[model samples]
Each structure stands twice: as C-alpha cells, then as structure tokens.
Target chain A: MRDPGNSGHPDQSGHGQRGSIEALQEHVDALEHQSKTTKRAHQEAMRRERQLRTHNAVLAQLSMNALREGCDEHVARREIVTAAADALNVSRVGIWLFGDDGQTLRAVELFDRQGGFARCQTVIRADRYPRYFEALRENRTLPAHDVHRDSRTKELLHDYLEPCGITSMLDAPVRIGGKLVGVICHEHIGPQREWTLDEQTFAGSMGDFVSLSLQMGKRNEMEAAIKRQREYLRQIIDISPNLVFVLDEETRFVLANKALCDLVSVPHQELIGNSAMNLIKDQEQARRLRKMDEAILRQSQLSIDCEESFTDRDGKQRWFHLIKRPITSVDGSGKQVLGVASDVTERKLYQEHLASMVRELDHRVKNNLFAVMIMAEHTAMGSNDIDEYLHAFNGRMRSMAIGHEILAKTNWQGAMLVEVINSLIRPYVGENLRHVTLDGPDVMLPARVAPAMCMMIHELITNAMQHGALSLEEGRVDVLWKVEDQTLHMNWIEHGTQDVAQFPQRGFGMELIERTAAHQLRGDAQLSFEPPGLRCELNIPLKLPADRHE
Target chain B: MRMAINAQLKDKLKDLRVLVVEDEFLAAKSLETSLRKMGCEVVGPASTVDEALAFIKSRTIDAAILDINLSPGTSEPVARALRYRNCPFVFITGYSNISVLPDDLRGCLILTKPTDPVSLAAAVGQLAEHART
Candidate 1:
C-alpha cells in the first residue's frame, strides 16, 4: 500500500526502484516459505496425533477384549495381531512365542494385509538367527528400518525379508513376569520404510498386551489347579472316620470336615468361623479344651494326645481320643490347631469291661488260693497220713477245677445243675455210669453257688466210693432232683451197702459239705443212714438275697 | 501241727472275743480255727454285712476281722458300722489294691488274702492292742 514517490532511492529512480522491488520480492518469498513449512509441520503433528489416537483406541479395545471372560489365548492372540497390523498400517503383523527351550520362535498367528489372517507356522531357531535372538535378549524394541542392511535383520534378508517382500522390520520382545518370553514382529513391504517412534512404542505395547493375556491364562490355570487340590483334600477329610477340624488362633473354627460337623450337630458351612468352645455341650469340658488349645498356641506344648469326654446335645456322654497339633495357617499368617478325634465311646466301654474282668479274675485267683489253703489244712487235720491227705485233697481240688471249667464255659455267668451233678459223679461212676442214675431238670446255678454245690456232690460220691454202694461192683445209686419254689430238692439213694448201714460218725468231709451248703448257699443239707445205704437231701435257694449279690 | 502263733501278740488275743466276717465258708472256718487256736473266743463268722452288723450290735465284739468283699458289695457298711461303734477292725481282702475303700475306711489296716494263720493272729492282735490303747 506504500507509494513509490516516498522512496528514499528516488534520485536513482528507475535503478533504485527495481532493486527495491527485488528485495521486497525476496522478503515475501521467505515469509511464504516459513508459512508453508509451519503448515506442513502442523499437518504432520496432527497426523501423528491421529495415529496415536488410533493406536491407543485399538490397544484399549484389544485389552478389553482380552479381559473378557471366555476369550481364550488363541482368540486374544489373533485379535492383538490383527489390531496391531491395522493400527500400524503394516504389511504383516505376527505373534511369535519362544519355546520352553528358548532356542526356537514359533509364529502363533500372522496377519497379512493382503492375504488376511493365517499362521506362518514358521519356526526360526536362535542358533540360525543369532543376531535376531541377541537383539531380542535386550528386552527392548528393535526398529530395523532397513531389513536387508540392518545387522539385526540381515541374517533374515534371504530367508525371510526376500521371501515375504519385506523391506523393513520392527520387533518388540514380549516379557511375562519380567522375563523375555516371545516377540511381536511388524513387517513392511515395498521400499524400505522408517519406523516412527510412535510405531515402535505401539509395538512395545502390543508385546505387553500379549504378556498380560498369557499371564492371565497362567493365573487361571493355577487357580483351577489350586481349587482341585483343595477339593481333593476336602474329600479326604470328609471320608475319614475321624473328626477333623482346624481352628484359628482365636479358637474359632477355620475348617471343619463332615465328621466333625456331624459330631457337633451342625453343618460344615455353619460350623466354620464359629467358636470351637460352643461345640462342647459342657462348660467344664469346653474350658479344659480351651486351656489345652491355648497351650498349643503358646507353643508350650507341641501336641496333645488325650482322652476327652463331653456330654452331647442329646445329653449322652461321648468320649474321644483327641490328638491336636499346632500348625501354621495356610496363609502362613498365624498359629492354628489341627485336631483329629476318634469316637472312642465303645472302645472305652470295652476297655473298662476288660479291666473289670481282669480284676474279677484276680479276685477269683486269690479266693481260690485261699480255698486251697483251707482244704490243705482241713485235709491234713482229717487224714492219718500223707497218702490220705493227698488223695482227699486232690479229689477236692479236682472237684473245684471241674466247677471252674463249667463256669468258664459260660463266661462265669452260671452253670447248669445237671452239669454240676454229672461232672462230680462221673469220676466215681466211671465204667458203671449207668449204675449211678442222675435225674434232674436243668437249673442254671449261679457262679457263686457252683463251687459249693460241687463240693457237696463230691463228698457224697467219695463216701459212696469208700464204704457205700460204690464199694460193691453191682452197686447202684439213684440221684433225683427237682426245683420247687426256687428251692433245689435232691435225694441220693444207694442200694449196695445195706450191711454198712450203721451211721458212721460225722467226718470232716460230711461236716464241711453240710457247713458249706448251710452257710454259703443259704440252704440246708441232711444225711441219714437207711437200710439201703445213705440218703441225703438238699434245699438251696436259687437266688441269693438281693443285698447279698456281688 | 498247729501253725506258729505270734509270740508277742498271743496274750492280747487270749480270750479276746473276736468277730469274724467272711463270705467263703472254708476261709471262714480256717479263720475260726486260727482265732480259736490263738486262745480267742471267736464270734459269728458272719457271711454278709447284715450278719456282721447284727453280730456287732448284739455280740460283745472286742476286736474284729473283716473280709472287705462279701459278694455283691464291699464290706464298707460293716467297716463304717465298726468304726461308729469305735470297734478296732482289720480288713482282709483278696484284692491287692484297697483304693476301693471309702474315704473313712482308707486309713484302716489292710491285709491281703491267703493270710497265714500266724499273720492272721498277729493282725487281729495288733487291732486288739490298738483298741486297748
């Protein structure tokens, strides 16, 4: 808009004006060049911003897809490679996984812009492509702008780049758990292409996405394995006959198996996290258990094997042989108690029974020893010589032994009256058993009464053998017995010793038999000499007086 | 031959009216013979707690020899009865362990079974001597 007349160079008018115009033209050209450069730079920046946006959007979508449940490894890998190839505008994009040996890289999925998705199924060995592997070992992205000239990809010039018509390559190492596991490769075709920093960064992020998905897959597999292991252990404890439970440091139930739950009359789910003290129906027992548990937790005791008794919900007493051990909790956070209890109620009863039986046997042995002592003393008193004493004492002992045998057969419950009578008389009647007739109903004589009755019967047989009917070959005897009003009535008649009918003075044997029957059996025994031989009758109460029973 | 009697306790047992409580008849007879040989007037060889208790109530029992186990139950009632009467008594039992006795009777004298006549006489003599003092 300035006028040419205001020019300082008016003196050299024409020449000066041309020079001035030239200078103005040069200034305009310089300004225009600066404007054009600024516009182009702004356009380049906008394009990069758009590319970054696209890359970020693609990565974001791929991450969300990978996170979706039921998106398997193969599906996630294909999505990642396709997204990378599309976002980066590359000819090919592939996911390569390093074998466990770390020597071979296998192409899992390759996305070809021209050919669509396919598996290159190419396995490249680290030994054959040493420089490529060495670069991957750096755990950083490698941007080989010229695939043929770049030393990192030069080894792949003939075999890979030429075959795939790739002029450039950008590879990013995939790391899982901070260890290099594989790589993501971006291959470009046509003329050599320079990889932008944004593209290299995008490649790195893709590797990260692959690592994350694979890490998630590994975690899922581990979680499933852990669940299976927990189930296996649960089944083991549930099937066990023993009551198993785990308690935390607070004495609350951390874990309880089916057996323990059933014992407490609670369900497995309901019992967990509940105080173990509540399971014991008795306060005193629970207190004692708490003390024991405390001791275990304090490490004052390593474990306890004790007999525990408690009243159950049904008010019935139950016994357990409980073994408890202090254990570190599964999370290794604090102390816990592992308890295994076996229901020993029946076993305890059996043990008590066995103890009582042993005591009873001891009592019987001592009592029998005392009885033997008395017999020896009495036999010595009544006999004139050693032979007489031995014979008589041996007979008495044999009678007692036979009685014991009968009692043993019945587990010391009782013996039948007929068996007792037959056993005593069989020794004397031997071959002439028919001559000594025994007639009686079967009566179960109590254990306490059997020995006394045996003694009486033995005395009668001895007398008959010595001087009564048994002294003669053709002698015969009739033994008949019956029970009436809980009283045992018996008559022993002899036929052959009539001439010896004169009543002999009462001997030690007769007195002992009579006294035993009268005192112990709480009964009476009478002996009379008749024309035939000897006649005896006994009346014994079947049951002892109530207070007198042992 | 008579089993030797304790020379030192023979006089204390002499003419002593001793009550014998035993269930086994033979053992009772043996105890009776031993007491009689010791120059003691033996009372009823009562076979049960009631029999012994009755004798304790009726008879002039200066000292007693009691079998701890009668049949169905222990001789705890008899021991208590004798204790109530301030009667000195010695326990004879086939059981080696006497922890079965009640608290009051645990302090009483105990003698295991198959006691020789001499020992039996001595135990009774000791009970009589303790009573005299």
Candidate 2:
C-alpha cells in the first residue's frame, strides 16, 4: 500500500487514505500476531497436557508398584527415575537420598535416555554445595533455568553443571514421615531450558512416591522377619517332648504343638478353636481343669503345677506332671494359659515300690533285734565263763550277719538255699570250705524264715566243730537238701570221725538246734548218734501257711 | 518260820498251772523256768498258735504268758481262747507298740522282749491272783 505515487498525495483525502491504510495494515499485523500467539499458547498447553498424561500414567504405575507385595526400595527408585526422565522429556534423571549423617546426598538410581540405566554411586557433600543443599531443604521444588546464574544452583556450576553438560535442573525434595529424606533431580543436558509449573509438580509427586516405596520396603522386611520368627517358634514347639499348648481365655485351644496333638490323637489344625476341656473325657478331671483355667483367667493364679492321670488308648493309666502358666495373648484378645505336661507314670510307680521296700526293711530290723536279745541270754546261760559267753555270742551274731548279707543281695526278697548253706558252713570249715559239700535243688527261703534257719544251722555247726567230727584233722561236713511236698528236707552228716556217739552236749548248741527248728521255724529236727557221725534230718515248710504280713 | 512262810507262798501257787506260748525256744524255756520257780505247774512252751490253742483246749491252764508273734501265725488265737476260759494272760512281744495287739487284748499286760525273769514271774503271779478273784 505504500508506493512513490502515494507519498505525493499530501491532500486531505490522500492523508485520510494513508491513515486508513496504515490502520488497516496495523490491524492485519495485530491479527497475524494474535493468531501466532494463540498457536504458540496451544502448543504449550498440549505439551503440558502430554507431560501431565505421562506423569499420571507413571504415578499410577508407581503407586501400584508401591502397593505390590515385596516391592523393595531399589525397584521403586528405578521406576521413579525412569518415569521422571520420560515424563519431563529430560535426558538424565536420578534419585539421591541423604545419608544418615545428613551431610551427603548419594545417588540411588540414575537413568539416562541414551544409556537406558546406569549404576551411579555419585555423592554430593553438603559442605561442598551448602547453597544447593540449603535451597533443597528450604524449597519443595528447586527450579533453576540457568544453572550458572541461579543463586540456588551456582555452587554446582564449576563441577556438576559444567562437567555433566547440564544447563538447567528441576529438583523436588523427598520427605518421609514429615522429614526431608532426599531429592528427585531432573537434569536438562542441552541449552538452558525453563522448568514449567506442571513439571515441577510432577517432580514433587515422584519424591512422594519414593517416600511411599521406602515405607513399603521397610514394612515388607518387617513382615518377612515376623513370618520367619513364627515358623522358628513353631518348629521348637513341635519338637518338644512334653505336651505343649496355648489356650485362650475361653479355654479354647489357640495353639497346639505336635506333642499335644499326638497325645490327644488329633490333628494340630483341627485342635485350634476346640475347647481344651473336650480333649479330656473324664468329667471330674475336665471340671478340675476348667476351674484352674478360670482361676488363671481371673488372674488369681499366676501358674499351677499338678499331677494328673489319663487313661491312654491301651486302657493303661498314665500319670502326668502338668505345669500351666498365664501369658499375654499375642492376638490381644485376653490372657491365655501356656501348658506343658511331662509323663511321670514310671516315676510314681518307682516311688511306691521304694516305700514298700522300706516298710519290709523296718519289720526285718525289729525282728532281728529280738533274735539278738534271745541269743545273748541263751549264750550267757550256757557259759561258765565270760570269755566263753562272748565267743559264742560273737559267733552267733556273725552267723546272723552273714545270712543278712546274702539276703541283701536279693534286696531281702529271699535267700537261695545253696547260698544259705555255704554262708553258714564256710566259717567253721575255712580251709575245708570245699570239703563241706552242699547238694540241693535250688530253693529260695522266705524272708521271714531265713534268719531263724541261719541260727539253727549255726548251732549245729558249733556242736560239730567243738566236739564232733569237725574237731578232727580229716573232718568234713556234707550237707544235702531237696524240695518235696512244699517242704525243704535237708540232711546233715559228718564224716572222718569214728566217735559219733561221743558227741558232747556240754554246751546248749545241741538243744538250741532242736529248739529253734521246733519253735521259730515251725519245723522238726531229728538227730541220731548211731551211724555216719551224728546225722541230723530237718524238714521245713517251703511256703509258710497264712503268714502274709502285708 | 521262814521256811513255813515260803511253803505257804508256794502252796498258793503250787496248783496254779501256767501256759507259756513263745515263738523263740530260749525265751519260751526262760518263761517256763520262771513260772516253775514260783511253784506254778507249767502246761507248755508252745511255739505256735495251733500248739498253744491245742494246749488251752486240752490242758488245765489258770494263767498264761503269750508271745504275740509266732512264725506262721500270731499268739492272738491262744490269748483269745485263754481269755474265753477266764484264764488271765500277759503278752510278751518283740514289738514295742501295744497297738500290735488286737483291740480286745491291748488292755492286757504287755512285756516287750528282753524282759527280766523276775517281771515274768511277777506278771504270772499277778495274773493268777487276778484270775482267782
């Protein structure tokens, strides 16, 4: 519209036309500018919308990952760095966490569009870049359009910004439990670029996702530890020899070990939630158990130890020493009882047997004392001198002691017939012990008759030794015995002496033999001095009639 | 005059028959000797319940000394038979406890083993005198 001919028109019409044309040109320029600005604004809005869409998708993915089971902090960090780089269209992105000392930032996961993923152990010290660190602490999001000029980022220009070819940076502080943890940094490697508000907000969200991931990782670790601990405890309980169980306040089984389950003949899983009372069939036992359980629940008793008897599947009664203690329930419902029972059946039986043995011993000791008194009085009666009396009394007492020693071998139950004869005859025929031969079928004397029989045998031996065949050099005694018709029939014969009828009856030994056999043993004895050196025949009842002392 | 007084005491006991039931032969002989010394005619030194019981049934017994423990059985039956006949008896036992005697016989005089001969004679004399009354 502006030409050489148009410049000559200085008239009012020409001036008016020039003014209108200028105005129209100005209006066209304005319209074109308006259209161009609108196009730029539309492009900017679309870019932001795309960035937001990426952020939303990435955040949704990160949130899902954070919620996933066993998603650790490292995996979560990788996801954040990769997602941030992609959303912001930046080449390099990394997540750095503050060390425990709060003086250093260490890169946990670093991602680059060109390199895909890189292992970075890069650390930035707070003392080295105090300005940058302070900015991070003070600001939720630090946006530096010019890395060398921004007061918040200038400290990084010499080493970080220049070396990495990073002209711009957008970083968001990571916080966990209301404390600053670290930062998620998006670095632009090309010419200086501005960080948009939408991008800054997206960075903040990534930092939040990191916090959640850290928490999730910690929770996963705790859960795994708890599971392992529970399994370990289960194993320990199962292997225990004692019956073990945990019962709730209602007396229902909350936990039952293999020992308890095996005892009840029930499956472990099946025992839980069942009443402990149901396991015991006896009404009286179950009632007592319930009373104890109630007392424990009421806190009146801290623990109880009691003996209980249970009839097993074989119909044999088994005793158990049971211990129950109150414990705080893990489920937090109420107090519970932890019970352990040890089988004590054998121990109880042993204790009863020991008591019976002691009673038998008491009876024997008293009876033996009476026998001693009788022997002392009798010995004194027969002796003309104190020395003679002492010798006889000592011999009698020794004979009694030998018999007791033999009986003690069998716990005083009985003495074998052969053993009794050998023990009594051995002392008198010391060098000739083997010469005094005993021939008899094996027999056991009742404890009641043993000591008296010993005394009778002692008297016979004394008479033979003092005056009969035993006094001669080549003298020997032959004893033979047999069991017949429930009677111990024994015969004693002396050899190597011709003067059988000259047997001395000066001492009371001969009379004592006859008297003991008749009175104490309830038996009979016959002595004849005619034939083979004063042969004596004895007969005693093997099993005394109606002498059950018990 | 002393001889006459002794004879008079002897006459009081001369016809009194005492029974001795002891399980131990020596102890039984001692009892019989003690009773005989006191001028009492001795019936038996029975070492068993059956022997003593048989003597109580057949022999004339005015007083008795019974050893409580016999080998096969106790002298309780003999004491019972003697008491039934109104013949007074004293129990000689190795057991120190009188509780070993039956409830009916626990009231009787009890002499533990190792008792003196004088006490045995005195017990028999007292039992004989009591029985006559």
* Candidate No. with top DockQ: 1
The candidate that achieves the highest TM-score relative to the unseen native structure:
1
Docking class of 1: medium
Kindly list the per-residue Cα lDDT of model 2 for residues A504-535, writing each as its tens digit.
66356777777778777778889877644878
Best by lDDT: 1
- The per-model DockQ list reads 0.52, 0.34
What are the runs in model 2 whose C-alpha is more than 4 Å off? A1-50, A227-245, A255-273, A302-325, A339-358, A373-394, A408-423, A432-435, A438-453, A466-468, A480-491, A496-530, A534-550, B1-133
Evaluating just chain A, the predictions reach TM-scores of: 0.75, 0.75
Model 1 lDDT tens row, A1-550: 9975456755687887787788889988998999999999999999999999999899889878975775677788888888899998888998888888977889888889899988676678889998888898785799999987889899987777788888888999999777788899999988888999999999999989889878877777788899999999999999998989899988999999998877668987788889998776668878889999999998899999999887776888889999999999999988899999999999999999998778878977988998998899888888899998899999999999999999899987889988888788777666548778888888898887888889888888888888788777877889999999888888888887767544566887788777777777778888887767888888888776563433
